[model samples]
Target: MTAEKRIPLHILREITNGFSEHSRIGRGGYGDVYKGVYSGREIAVKLLHVDTVLGHDDRQYINEVGNLLKVKHPNIVQLLGYCYEIQNELIEHNGANRFTRHVYRVLCFEYLQGGSLDKHLREESFAPDWSTRYKIIKGICEGLNFLHSCEPPIFHLDLKPANILLDSSMAPRLADFGLSRLFGGSHTHVTNRVVGTEAYMPPEFIKDAYISHKNDVFSLGLVMIEIIKGSSGYSGYIETDEVGQFTQKVLGNWKNRIKATSEYPLEESHQVQICIDTAMRCVEPDRNNRPNIAEVLDILSKTETHIPKRQMADVFPCPTIGLKSESNMLEIMVAELNNNEHIHCNLMPTDNSNRTVQQLADRETSSDVEQVIIGRTKEKQKILSILSESITEEMVNLPIYGIGGIGKTTLAQLVFNDPKFQDYTRVWVYVSQEFNLNKIGNSIVTQLTDKISNIPTK
Candidate 1:
C-alpha cells in the first residue's frame, strides 16, 4: 500500500474521459464509481456528490477514508489516492448571477477486474466453482474479523455482496465503508439513522437501531449464504422455520454442483456444509445468539481440517492440436495432495536448492512463445511480487495450480524466462502425479552437472 495522495480533479476527468457515462462503473447512495487510469496503472475513481445542506455525504466520505487509512488487510480494499477540491462557478440564484461554491470529493482505489460479487450472485447462468466461492466466503470472514479485531472494533454497517469486489484471481476485497462505525467501550452503540441495504440488516440493527460487532456478523451471514446458494438463499432462509432442513437443502444443492465439477468433491462438500451452518448461526435474530466474526472464522478454519492435507498438481502447456484433443491432453495435472494456491495457479517448484532465487520476477520475456501468450501479465506480475518479497537467503517454492486449460504453463514460462533470473542456472523438469522427491532431486543434480560440464574449462 502507498500513502494516500491528493489527486487533482482535472486529471481524473481526463482519465475517465470527462467522467463520461460510458466510464461509469457503478452507482451508490453517496456517489458514482468510474474506471480510470492513474500513474500508468488502472484505478477506480469514486466521485462523491456534495450535499450543501446537512453535509451528511461529507461525513460519509470522511468516515470511509478515515477508516480505510487505519486498516491494511489483503481482503480489505486499498485506498490509493483521493481528491478534495473546491470549485466556484457563476450560477443564477434568486434571479441574480452569483458565484456558488462546490466541493469535489473523490476516492481512488486499486482497480478490480472481476467487478462486484453482486453481479456474479445475481446472474443465474454465472456460477463460480465451489472452491472460488469458498475462498471468497473465507476472505470476507477474515476481513470482517480484522475489522472487529481493531482497537475499539470497526463495524462495517453495510456488508453485502455489492460491497465485495472480486479481483482478476477471484479474490474478494471488502469495499464501501461509508456506514462503518468504531465503538470503543462496551463495544456497542445505538442510532436511529439506520441506512444500508435492508435485506442484509440484522433484526437488531433494523428494528431497535442496536449496533454491535454482531451487526456486521449478521450481514456477513447473509452474504455467505448468497455466495453459497445464489441471491435467493437469504430469502429462502428467512422463510424457513426448519433451519436445519433449509441448511441441508443448501448443502445438497452445492453437493450436486461439486459432484459435477470438483476433483475434491468431499472436501468442497464439507466447505459448503460449514458455510451453510455458519450462515444459519450468523443470521440469528437475537444478536446475542449470532456468532461474532472471529467465531465465524474459527469455524471456517475447521473446514481445512476436513480437507486432504496434500494434493500436489502439476501443469504444463503442450502444443494445441484441436479442441477435443487439447481439452484432453493440453493440461495434465496429477494431484493426490491439495493446496489452495495449487488449485488454480500456473506456478512450478524451484530447481535451485543450493542458493535460493531471491528475485523471480519483473524482467521482460518476449520470446516467440510469449508473443502468443495473452492475458497473463497480471499473473506474471503477481508471481513476481511474491518472489521479490521472499527472504534473500531462503527458498520459497511457489506451486502454480488452476483449472484445466487455464494457461498455467504460459504463466510459469513467463515467470521462468524473465530476465531477472538470468544469473541463476535454470532447469526445467516437468513433475507429474507420480511425485518422487528422490527422483526429482536426482534429476536436478543431473541437470546441474550437465550445465557445469558444458561450462568452458578456462
Candidate 2:
C-alpha cells in the first residue's frame, strides 16, 4: 500500500464482519488470529486489540509496521496489507452497561496450515517422528542463514518454538518480523532494555548487557534443545538457581556422545547429539564464543543426515532452594521497610563536601512529583553529553532509571543521536506501552544478525 492511500474504515468493517468464529485460528497478546478467505485465497489476519494512532502505544505500533515493511525476504512472513477501524460498542458486566470506543489494527499474512510448533509438541497425540523434527530444525537454520547473509545481518531477538509455523507439507517458515533489527554498520553491539522470555534469554541480555547477534544464537540454541527433547526444555529451569548448571550438564553429555562416534544407535542418533552440542555452543556464557547464524546452519546441515529417537536420560535439575531463600529474604526486607512508615531521616549529610548527594536526591524527588525543569536547553544537552561519556567508558549494564517526565528517555535519545554512538553502530528502539516481548526480540535478531525471519510451523 502507498503512503498516500489509506484503507477505508468501511472496508475494515466488512472484513471484521466476515471474521466468524469458524475463521478464528488463534489468539495472542495483540488480539485474535483469524483464517480468512479474501479474494478466493486464504490468509491469516492478526487483528490488533488496540489502536495505532491513539494513546502512548501509537508510536510503538506504527514503528513496528514501518520496520516490517522495509525488510523483504522469502523466509520472513510477508505483510500483505493492514486494516484500521474504530467502532463504538456497549459492554455489560455484572448487569452494568457502559459505552466505549474499540479500535482495531489488523494485519494480513500468508496462511500456514501446519500451525505453530509449540501447539504440536504440547499435544500428546501430535508427536512428530525424529525425521520430521530434524527437517524442521534444518529449515529453521536455513532461514536464519539467509537473514545473517543479508547485506547487513539481522537479529531475531526472540527465537522460540511458538513463533515457528509450518506449511501444509510441514515445511518450516518464520512468521513474525515485529522484533527483528537490521545491523547497519561496523559497531557489533547495542545495549537494549531487558526484553524477551527470561528462560530462553541469555544472562547478558537479562542484565541489560550489550546485545548482538550472539544473543539470538543463544536463544536459538534453547529452542533447538526444546525441539530435540520434545518439550519446553527451559520452563522447568524457571525460578531455579542451578539453571545454568543443568543446561551445561545436559549439553555436555550430548556433545560427548556426538564426538565419540559417527554411526551411533537409532536411540542415540549422532544427529540429535550434534544438534544438542551445537545448541550448547550457541548458549555459551561468552557471547564471543557463540557461533554465527551461517556457522549454525552449516553445523545443522551436516547433522541432518540421520534421525534419532527420544531417549529418557537422567534430566539435570536446577537448584531452586538458594533462589527461593533469596527471594524470601528480599520479600521480608520489603515488608519490614513498609511497616516502619513513621521512621524518616534527613538524607543530607552533615559534611559540607557531601551536600551534592543531598541536592541530587532532592532534585530526583522533586522530578518525580513534577516534570524536571530544564531552564536552559544548552545545559540539558551538556548534562546528556557528560552522562553518555561516562556510560561509554564502562562495559556494564547501567539502567537510565528516573521519573517518567524527568528526561530519562530524552537523555537516552540524545545519547543515541551522538556522533560517538555511531562508532558502535547503535540501534535506537523504544519499548513503549505496546511492547510485545516476542516482537521486540525478533526485531533485535533480524536487525543485528544474519538470521532469516522465516518461522517454521508445528
- lDDT per residue for candidate 1 within 160-252, as digits (tens), equals 888999988778999987678777889999886867788888887777888888889888888887888776435524655687787888888
TM-scores of all predicted structures? 0.66, 0.52
Residue 125 lDDT, candidate 1, scale 0-100: 73
The number of clashing residue pairs in each candidate reads 11, 41
Error of 2 at 164 (Å): 0.7
Model 2 CA deviation exceeding 4 Å by range: 1-9, 18-23, 51-63, 70-74, 84-104, 125-128, 186-194, 236-268, 304-458
Query: Which structure among the candidates has the greatest lDDT?
Result: 1
Quantify all predictions' global Cα lDDT against the true fold: 0.72, 0.58
